[model samples]
Target: MGNLLGSWRFKEPSTVEECDSTWGSDSEDDEPAVEDDSGVSDSVSPERERAAGDSSPQLAEPRDSLPKMKRSFYAARDLYKYRHSYPNYRKSRQPNEYRNLCFYLNKIPLVPDGIYIEEILTKWRGDYDKLEHNHTYIQWLFPLREQGLNFYAHELTQDEIKEFQSTREAKRRFLAAYSIMLDFYGIKLLDKSGNVARASNWQERFQHLNESQHNYLRITRILKSLGELGYEAFKAPLVRLFLEESLCHNTLPNMQHSVLEYFVYTIRLPATRRQLLRYARQHYRPAHAFLWGPPPKRRGGGGAEGSVGAGSSGIRAPAPTPEPQRRAEESSPTASSGIIVSSHDAMMCQELGGEGLKSSAGLGSSMSRLEGALMMAGARGEMNDYSEIVPL
Candidate 1:
């Protein structure tokens, strides 16, 4: 009974034995394990194998190889370096940076283009010195002339006039300014002796240009100026140019209107007006009636003197038409003579009491009514009667 009890007694193993039991079994189970020659475990873990496989040796080389990428990494990263140092950089390269900047002494703000002379004059209030002193302000003159500011150009100083006459841009401006002054204001560029300056020169220049050149705008302005200043002198030239030149055909309505306006406003002579009407009737019959209100009536004897001085004479005598006989002649004359007299000869013969003579009272009554029509037409701003007086 004592031996049986001793054999059944349980005792714990030593630490070394316990450790060998646990580790030794696991090591034997693991296949192809490495042994450490230095007595330390040389077995690599799964994590260590993965890290060794991923790691690679790198060769040292320059980062930038192209000319464009020559900047260092530190310099590229420092972005604010340029912003702080640009002034110094510009100072070093001053020639290139400052080439475009220009400064002018006594410069004023430029006026807006197409400014009117009236507005400029009103602003300046006729103070010539202010404009004359400033070179920059004087530069505005050319643009002003382009906008048709002739009156202001006419007021140029002697220095300015000399500048204008000599400069290339001044040719047209000088002509336009002087012409406008003479036409509208009856003022000419005069000498100290009060004689017209360059009068013959202007005439010769304009007349020669009319024959040689075809600058339509300059020619038109010249013609208008001369017509307003001296109609009798320009009349023949204007008529010839209007009839012969291509300006009338190419610039249709504007040209026609300008020609008609000249005749309406400038020409005051009776014979001149008659000749204009006849020419217009022969050439442009469509606009003839609109331009010249009514044709002259058939005149009896002793009417030549009246016709000649009709423009000077304020009151015009109306010629009575024998419409009853004239209309009868169109169909067939019922008179025993069976012969037709021209309207003019008939009127003369009737006034002489040869035949078809109306009573003086009847003729006077007809004349009174005709005179009222003429007066009303003139008052209403309608086309003037062809035979009406043209006031000088």
Candidate 2:
């Protein structure tokens, strides 16, 4: 312990004269010969050490950088990838809200413009000879038509139909009013020869009707009236419109309702019903409860085995009959159209539902499926070729 303490003694600085004398006293040969290896230790500077210390850690190498499949298998495992919300076919509505034309017209005052229809007709009786000559009446007719006074508006000439500028809301209201009037009166437009006005190309004049947002409702209403009257001449055009996603899928909930209502009306005809049902099948949704009935009441006895068997078939049975046709008078507006939408359909409708056949690609694919379905159902005659036509 004493020897170790002696070895730890501190040294004192040499005098200036002694340090000066010893500074260069020893030659290079006299200094202990230093050995040099590669001098690699000198290469690492303080700056490099600081930089290495500050750098972030690197990620580990991927286990399978280039898998055989180009597609991502992990994507399939994500449950959300395939999950989607269903569309609402019959969204909830107030009890008083009317869906039928007849009841609505019957319930509302006939004097939609705050004046009697007979009085207006009497005032304009002088202009009866030359309908266009009564510019004031024509002007009055258009505003009232815009106001949804369809009963009175229907009395106007075809020239009036042209004169009435088309708008989305205006067209919808007019059609709703006009359709009810037609249903009530059973009035038919006739040519000079007393023949039903049957122009093969009347639909052609309004070809661009549904092309824009402004006129879509107008076209939809016209199509509905044509269908209600059983105007089979417009059947092909209606089918073509069905194929158009833009026309079928609209932002306006009422517009969508009109289209669906029109579909219900059109399907009363056996020929169009088959095609529409076929379309509904491929795009089967709980919202389509109106058309396809409640999802086949599940059978508890079948369980998984039964479901597997049903799925194995991959084809559903024919749908049930839709509700009755619209009642023109006495029925509440909601129940006006004899069509009875079940509670199940209403329940299925989402808060933001009513988007039907909204995508062209989806529509085309579904239509193809429908065509095949119709062919199998022996509806070849009803299958009108709609390939070349673009309704817009």
Question: Each candidate's TM vs. the true structure?
Answer: 0.23, 0.23
lDDT of 2 by residue, 254-318 (tens): 23323432332332233333344334333322221222211122344221111101001111221
Clashing pairs in 2: 88-349, 98-333, 98-334, 99-333, 99-334, 102-328, 324-338, 325-338, 326-337, 326-338
> lDDT scores for all predictions?
0.29, 0.27
Candidate 1 whole-model C-alpha lDDT, 0 to 1 = 0.29
- TM-score, prediction 2: 0.23
Deviation (Å) of 67 in candidate 2: 36
Which candidate has the top score in lDDT?
1
Tell how far residue 235 is off in model 2, in angstroms: 2.6
Candidate 1: which stretches are off by over 4 Å? 1-221, 227-235, 243-254, 263-277, 287-290, 293-392
RMSD per candidate (Å) reads 52.5, 39.6
